[model samples]
Target chain A: MEDPMPFGTALHDRVRDEHPDLDHLVRVATRSGTRIRRRRHAIATAVTASGVAAVAIGVAMLGGSDLRSGGEPDVAVQPTAPASHPVDQPPRTRAERAHARALRALQDAPVYVDSPDWRCDQPLDEKFICTHGAASVVVVWRPAETWADYQDPAKAGPETFISDVHGQFFATVNAGPDTTHAQVVEVGEALIWAE
Target chain B: MITDAGKDSEDFGDFVRATGTQLYRQALLLTGDHHLAEDLTQTTYAKVYASWRRVSRADNPVAYARTTLLNSFFSHRRLRRSGELPTDPTLGRESSAPEDDPETRLDLLAALTILPPRDRAVLVLRYWEDRSVADTARDLGMTETGVRTRSRRALQRLRPLLGAELTERTM
Candidate 1:
């Protein structure tokens, strides 16, 4: 029996005859991976610098507080301690507290990678790249204040949530087929890129 | 040792060779112009290549590619609201005569261009791809009811623009 709608099939057949050069298409596809990898690296470097600065300020405050209290400053002490502990001591400034919180949250956050073989290079110049063979993934931090100032909250997904203490925002990007938009959002929440 | 990245490149190259033409054809219909169709097809392949590891492992890689192509098309349309025609003259000229009567084909392409991107997508998936209503709905991220409604409306919209001669060809 003949199909009732021959026009659709005819149109499809006609269009199919117009073939494009396969080599050109393949070249473009291959190049896109490199472009994505470069962009991800740049973003990761920017985010890591801010994270490191926050951590340094947090350490300075702890050391300063310990010295003023006539106690030996513990370099390895966690920054989760309250800023208003000593009644006679001056309280930490708002910026100090925020940095402390952000650093703490980032330390506790999970790292998400797309694959097990991917490994992050040691932080050098506040930048690191997680690589799996030739593919690379980059994770970056964007503070909530910065995100809110620039981005529309309504468009952001749940993964775009900021840390309760420091108001830090994070996002991830990579040059891989599996690094989808939803996966990027999930990476933002975890602040780690693997795969 | 053959690296994973090397293997990925080889596999992606093969996939593009096998499916590039079919995808370009679909893009040509979707865009109604050759140059735009080529750009759209290339972008789709690039996205598929970016997620090659996962996409290749999918149960139906062809369907995945098609979905990617449609999403790319709609996103481009949304980003650029202009109805600017292709600047290249040589593009639309090549396929101007697909059948004995060139007028019918031209009219069909014209009518398709008039429909909104989403509406055109619904019709193409339904008729050209011969996809079921459920599949079309899932592909377009619309409800089955919405697909049916859009399909009916798009056809009605195309019917008037296609005029009497081309309308009879569909039936």
Candidate 2:
């Protein structure tokens, strides 16, 4: 037998070598592409509307503030989402390019849990790990997923409670060994949509 | 490529036209269901569309979209399942002709059908896509060691049916 023979040759021979009628697949994808266009339109509108709303809110806050008095505004509404990407480790491979994008998405995540007073960090690629005291919560933000409402509570496990803010993100709370179920629930309730 | 909105719109169509079929094929290999594959592909497209501005800036847009498709499979597969793995005859039969080793093919498909999602993903990325172990680990957000462990476990499950050389090496 050859040393270090190629891996999964049988699989490639079966799946790759074969030429099936895949024409229908293109048609299916094209037909479904319209839904994506609609979603794109809706998201664009939300983004624009949110932009306008932000400007208005910013203007209002600016007008009400006594900045002319040379003092900081009390009870300041946060201008930036607190989620950030502190992991500056450059990707080592081609696939890590996508991993890097996921890390960026975590920083741009719209929702954040404020009650537990957590600092969200990307210890992995896609998910954000937010820690408060002994507990840590996992937050995964799919910015483009503005229409998919598919939620799986079973995947939450006995230790975690999930805030499946459908179409935007999923937050898995109560992650650390010392975190309690109630702490997770509290975090879930305190989630703020910073969009 | 500093494209305006009109060009970006056209570019996305071209992007989908170019990559949709391959993505669908890959999804089929992963899910073993035509409908599920279509759903996975569409969802992937929609998600990718929403992130087009960022995705378009990727070094390799095709690979980025492919990674999106794999992640989409993991994210949404559980939502559409009926708490049972489908054993329908149409599970993995995209063959164009009768196989000389039809029994072996059947056994392999059967083994694949029973394989866990992450294991199957590791196998598909490593084998069907011909990605490196490092690439597969990066794509799946797993360490290289974790990918090897999963690959071994996955191959072990298929060993009874496939007796593949890769499984032999891992064993």
Candidate 3:
């Protein structure tokens, strides 16, 4: 302690001359901080992706619930339209009554769903489109082309079924995931043409 | 990949390489415990590295790192020594080396332990770091007058402890 300088200088000299384990400490600190930052960035990305997925699911659900009500078809079967066939002869065949019943069911069917489902649409003037849940049935008033079962590529479901009901009417049932083959046929058979 | 983040990390590592020794010495003066000083120095660098983008953009990154170390010391001053004293096993090895006045070193550490953390910080910045009254004030977030007063009072407190230690050594 000879010529012990002022306490401050002595203190500074004591620290300034000292050495510590620098390599290990600096390496650990830098690595730990960078790892934590990368973890936070990954978590943020995952949260953003999940948020987008949730919004898409919400929009899809809202679309289905939007048009769930049972309402009249876009085109009603006009009773006064010019008949293409003789009107006085009553259809006495068993198949004739079934076709008329199917047309009646079409007039009683509900409102339309949106693009995600088998959305009900009419491509012809005399055709009336109606929906039941995810399933749809299109009724043609006069003799028209018997359309075939067509797959809607965008949706995951069974193919649609189109069949001429009697001699003068065509019934097309769009089969959705919720509807089976027999269920779609039943939907086609639901149409009626009662006076 | 040399992305912005990668560059920031590289720059931070370089900064640590340049300033780590000086900062560790400053921590040693502040805490008077080799292992504790090492811990404090590592923690300070880690905080700076975490916000490397902002820290690198600062006018004086060394000053920024010093402030963070001081703040951490003030907040967690009683950081447990894991049931140990201010001295550590490493200093025993350090004391045997040449120019190691073990008794004088012990006296300094014992003297520092008498004062509270704020007074210790004032002494460290003023004496060890050779910071001006104004610079010490900014580092400790105190007024210049407060730095002067604390430095005066802290020295007044340390005098007798050091005197007693020297007398004990002479006997």
Candidate 4:
């Protein structure tokens, strides 16, 4: 059999010659038109306004999880390390406390994940905002000993909660009924669902 | 972030008018079907609109647009779960009949259909646009040698479909 023709300028010309309305195609592809843009802008504006109002009211109700329930325990930042001694010192700032909590959480958390699947497939239920059917690892934090050594039953965070969709990082923040707490999670490439 | 409406539209319009035809041809070759080509083109523009501020400032806006289009194509493929895109009119319009040899045109389209999207793009960029191997390499992010290799392989695959006469006459 004769060898297949090599694709080069000749082939390009042939395709071009056959299809003359090529510009229109690109135009059609890239042109979302003004209406779509306007709609997108309106939606974004509304969302921003709502977000501002939420901040003003000192409460942000993100989709999923009912943070307004009365029985919910207060979510507080955990300490970086287990207390060694009663060394009298200035109380840590909120930012300092959150950072220390993140560092300690990373260092001392005990998770029994052997594979990526085990890590990602941890159950998330109606009470906990997590993957219902999807797989994800869970990271839980215990509150500081001085305040109350409690893991708020209503609060859960996935310190390694990588999305199995857009690969965007999402740290769960459980701030009780009125305050906000967050977990720093890393977004991994596989979370993009390349497969 | 200068977001002047009139200035942006005019600049985007000029860019579209200048590069639209070339992009269409490239899209047509990549998808083989006209409607899919149009859909690809339109999506490309929407993306350009979304990032027009940064894109307009870049020295190689065309390159940015092309990459955007390619990424869009790949993304659609992932969503659709198949590389075999539809030729439905809802996607894009039918190709216009050109005053050329029908057999040659058919042969070319047939040959293009057999090649992978990237290979088709390489040929379109190389020949129709009259770009150097280096320029094609730069645009497609392939090494010069890789471009040459793909080009050779693409031609070799197209030769049999085009037949001996077409190859000799065209080459």
Candidate 5:
């Protein structure tokens, strides 16, 4: 038998001989010509319409009170029922429950904890201690309900902020330096690390 | 030499005209069936057209299309749950046809069928398409080292299936 041939040369020859054809497959690109042109036109029209709408909205918002007559505000104060609890949200975790308890316990009172080092920058709750780093910061807890009551002077005495962290509502109270404290606060079920 | 704002249909047509035949041939080599090759080519182009705007902007549109086509083949196999391998009937058909003395073309195709989908694709990209490791890696969504390792393993696997003439020669 003859000597065996070189694999690279043989493979190269084979590939060169068997290279795939190109012209026929592009036929569809030619076939869909009309549809493509129509698509481009539609895209252009949509973009122009969006630009016009944006300009109109910007002008109206900027015009503000000047655009309206000296008439009563159109704010409607209809009493609508609160939305039902969402069914899609997953069940709360253990950490989340603990966070809620911590937040509710320190609404007005200053709760404190100390830590050496921490990784995350943002505060977890009203009082947060950096267990990982020597750094720490105090957060202010301004409960929305309490703030609203304060704004409405007609309402009764100082509203208490201390309560169950309402659905994903928690705060961080800002205390003086030299104290590294973190308060594990929760809102409904969501947990936050206030420092 | 077409610009981004070139006529969409004409550009797509040009792209297909430029690359379709080679893609069909590659599909045939991979699947070892004329009908399957045709279907693969049609499906590949349909997808390419669907994303033509994005793909055409890529540094190497041909490479992008090649990856899309090969990935489609693997995905099709996965959906069929045929263990991602050709059934015995298809294998037998591929082996039986064009059998006389086994030319290099036949040898390469046969050896390729025995390889796993990814390996087969690696060989197609590396040797057949003349793509560099970096280009192949980008197309396959793998690292350059990954492409090299896979290419080496595929070449090793193919050696046994090839004739002594091909097996003995250094790559």
Candidate 6:
């Protein structure tokens, strides 16, 4: 019996012969590039405008004499907290402050740990683990690190704590002396940051 | 020295002219429809053009282009789950009413449409493009063993549809 190479070659040749001309491919590609550039420019403009508007609103709210009557001048605005919880009088205990900060960082994250018994535990020096039912996340507070360290956690050092939930693994790593980053990575999926 | 942007555009245009037809052929085999194949080819070229600076610098740009094309095809397939070419009974009847040299080719393509996208990709890359099993695995983002298994299974599936004449020699 002969090899199937001839048959495969014939098939390839037929398909190749049937392909239409490539004159329009370059045109389509150029148009696509233009479209992408326009999209990026529009997004950037929107982001910049939003940032400016937010800053203006913030300044207008804080600079108004009525809003700043009794509060400390040095403290920035804390929009998230209730009116009763002033920025100048943050949680007094270090653990409470850390927990608050962790909650703020993860406020916009897609996944949430929904157990009623969730508690943050400091198992190691400057390391906190919060668990609720099957879901748990560990946050490590580093003193002074660069953003690059957060981007490449593998180079930062060994993982302090790792927890697996729903086939996704979460790890906390010291990015720098002052920087800590938490990341969740699932197999065949992109790395998602908890920041 | 040419500016980077000018050089990138020129290189991309040249690359498209050089290998566009071959990529279109591969797309045709993968899609089993001429229109879909053309769309896939154009999309692939557009991606390559967008990433021209990096892709043109790659050691094997052809392989990179092939990988990009396969990725575009698979992603397109994923986005439109029910949008694959229809294999209705009427179309099957029309396809069975054979012509001369085109009959065997149409039969081969018809059989190919039954396999899953990844399996079809494996077969086309292995047989039509004559890629090594390792290369096919890498292109499909699968293990070598996975590629082998898919290739064997794809051939088995095709044998019945393709009949003994086409299946006997190579597969």
| Per-candidate local distance difference test | 0.60, 0.59, 0.58, 0.49, 0.51, 0.58
lDDT of model 2 at residue B110? 54
**Fraction of true A-B contacts recovered by candidate 2:** 0.19
**Candidate 5 residue lDDT tens string, A1-195:** 542434444445444444444555555433332334454565466456555555554555545554465544333322121222111221276444444334433432233222212222222212232222332333334554554454443542222123334443444332122322232221111224333
**Top model number, DockQ:** 1
What is the per-residue lDDT of model 1 for residues A1-195, given as tens digits with 9 covering 90 to 100?
Answer: 654775576567557568899998898767754444444564465456545555755786878898899877656544332443221132276544433333323332333333334444322111234544544444534444555543455554333333222334434243332244454444334343221
Which 10-residue window in model 1 chain A sums to the lowest lDDT? A120-129
TM-score of 2: 0.52
Categorize the docking of model 5: incorrect
lDDT of 3 by residue, B97-129 (tens): 333476656656656766777898888787667
For model 6, what is the error of residue A55's alpha carbon versus the real structure, in angstroms, after optimal superposition? Answer: 12
Tens-digit lDDT string for candidate 2 (B126-164): 877878899999999999999989988877766654544
Model 6: how far residue A66 lies from native, Å: 23
Kindly list the per-residue Cα lDDT of model 6 for residues B99-146, writing each as its tens digit.
335765576666678778998898888888888989888878899999
Ranking by TM-score: 1, 6, 2, 3, 4, 5
* Cα RMSD to the true fold for all candidates: 15.8, 12.8, 30.0, 19.0, 22.2, 19.0
The CA lDDT at B134 in model 1 is: 97
User: Model 2 Cα displacement at A129 (Å)?
Assistant: 25
Error of 3 at A47 (Å): 9.5
Tell me the lDDT of model 2 at A32: 43
lDDT per residue, candidate 2, A1-195, as tens digits? 663534456565545543323344334444444445554575466456556556655864775665666656554444332223212243565445444444333334555544325555422222445666656555544444532333444543555565555445555554444566676676677665544
**Candidate 2 chain A worst ten-residue window by lDDT:** A79-88
Fraction of true contacts retained by every candidate, in order, equals 0.51, 0.19, 0.40, 0.29, 0.34, 0.39
| Cα lDDT, model 3, residue B75 | 41
1 against 6, candidate with superior lDDT: 1
Calculate model 6's interface RMSD in Å.
10.8
lDDT digits (tens) for residues B51-120 of candidate 4: 7777899999998988887776654432221234322222111122342666556546655666666776
Off by over 4 Å in 6: A4-7, A41-195, B1-7, B79-100
